[model samples]
Target: MNRITTLLILALLVFSCSDSKGNNDTNEKLNALRVELDSLKKSKAEASNASNKQIATFLTFQENNAEEAMNFYVGLFENSRIIDVQRYGKDGPAKEGTIMVATFELNGSKFMCSDSYIKHEWAFTPGVSNMVECKTNDEIEMLFTKLSENGKALMPLDNYGWSTKFAFIEDQFGVSWQLNLK
Candidate 1:
């Protein structure tokens, strides 16, 4: 009976030690899984942010006048400026010193332009135009006059019922604009 009791006591000690080791292993595995889940969440968030990036308007000119047009546009509106300009070298693709690529902003809207080496039969049409909302009548008038200087005014500034004042003009660069007074 004494030997049997000693054997039972040793058995209990061995079982308890194995059970505690198992618990430790389970805890380590759970912690590893939590870290992996956090890493996956961070990766998904970065990919989502990249996919939601902003889109900018692009213009292609064949006459090597992209730089001129970009500069003129940057000067027209408030809070407008040229972000960058990459000019073509003496290569045969485009004229030397011409704008290979140019980035600019007009009234806080981003725009990109480039002088195309290949000439296409199509040019800018008035079908798609940039719409500007003016805060005052004077502002609309000023923009209309300046934008129509060397260009054609498709619709003169006047009340069109739907709007208090509006004008449609094709700028010298052949880009169309619709100026509306708010």
Candidate 2:
């Protein structure tokens, strides 16, 4: 009876040793799954970064004012120019010679503007404004004065706690501006 029990114990030990080696195979599969998951995450991040490159700001203006607004903006910025302008034809919804769509650059930043023939109830509000950073006090002053012409100044140029000079103004075309000196 003792010899039979010893043989059974040896058989169980050999089976357990083989199962431990099987566990190493399971561990290898788990490590491979983890590596695959990491690679998928990296691929997703690269795709997101690529899609973020296509971004621009769009602005809408009243009838016949899109070109005027674009010209005004380009004139204000030193490194600015009108990229393109599309006008309405004689048989169009908008009046002939009026701007249909326009593209302009302001200080090297591109912006799209369009004139809507149909009137909209919504107008430019102070909630969304163009914030400009100026290098000198004179730059802020010049921009504030020009932007405030024929328009109201929401916040006068002054030294706020966070900046040396800051001013909020609504331009002649009702576009809000925040000129900051940095």
Candidate 3:
């Protein structure tokens, strides 16, 4: 009886060895699953990077005299018009010739102008400006130099990441301008 018991113990030890080959198939399957999960993670990261490229950016400005400002701006571009105008007057609102707000388009870009007619001093600052995207270096330089004729230069014409030459200036009438070569 003792001999039989000893032989049984030895057989059990052999079968229960930690380095046995039975787990190899399971390990290979687990490794394959890990590889697949890593591939999926990479694909998701790439997709997120692609989605981050879409950004809609628009510049803003304010003016105390919308009518004359719009008129002066319209003279600079061949194709420009006041798309809409909203006026607030002493009679409450919608008074003719009193422009409270004006929406216009200059060279396919939208611009907004408004008037503060409350007998107070309203002025335009350098904080807001229009960034014009030009086709060539010549165009950029021409616009920058033309706008800088009677104005102060905020940023001198220089090479920037998005253009060959760029400048920001406050025009003669206190309106700001940004010139860039696309």
Q: Write the per-residue lDDT of candidate 2 for residues 1-70, one digit (tens) a residue.
A: 4443554555455445555556766556555655655666676775565456465567888756888888
lDDT string for model 1 (108-170, tens) is 788999999999999999998999999998899999999999999999999999898999999
lDDT agreement of model 1 with the native: 0.83
What's the TM-score of every candidate structure? 0.70, 0.69, 0.51
Worst 10 residues of 1 by lDDT: 1-10
Ranking by lDDT: 1, 2, 3
User: Which scores greater on TM-score, model 1 or model 2?
Assistant: 1
Candidate 1: count of backbone clashes, pairs at least 3 residues apart or interchain = 0
Supply the TM-score for candidate 2: 0.69
Best-first order by TM-score: 1, 2, 3
lDDT of 3 by residue, 1-182 (tens): 44435545554554455355667755555456556556666767755654564532222223445677677777665567667787776675444456766777677456666655454465567787777877878777777777777778899999877766889989766788888777
**Model 3: how far is 14 from its true place, Å?**
96
Evaluation by lDDT, superior candidate among 1 and 2: 1
Whichever of 1 and 3 has more lDDT, that candidate is 1
* Top-lDDT candidate index: 1
Q: Model-by-model lDDT, in order?
A: 0.83, 0.79, 0.66
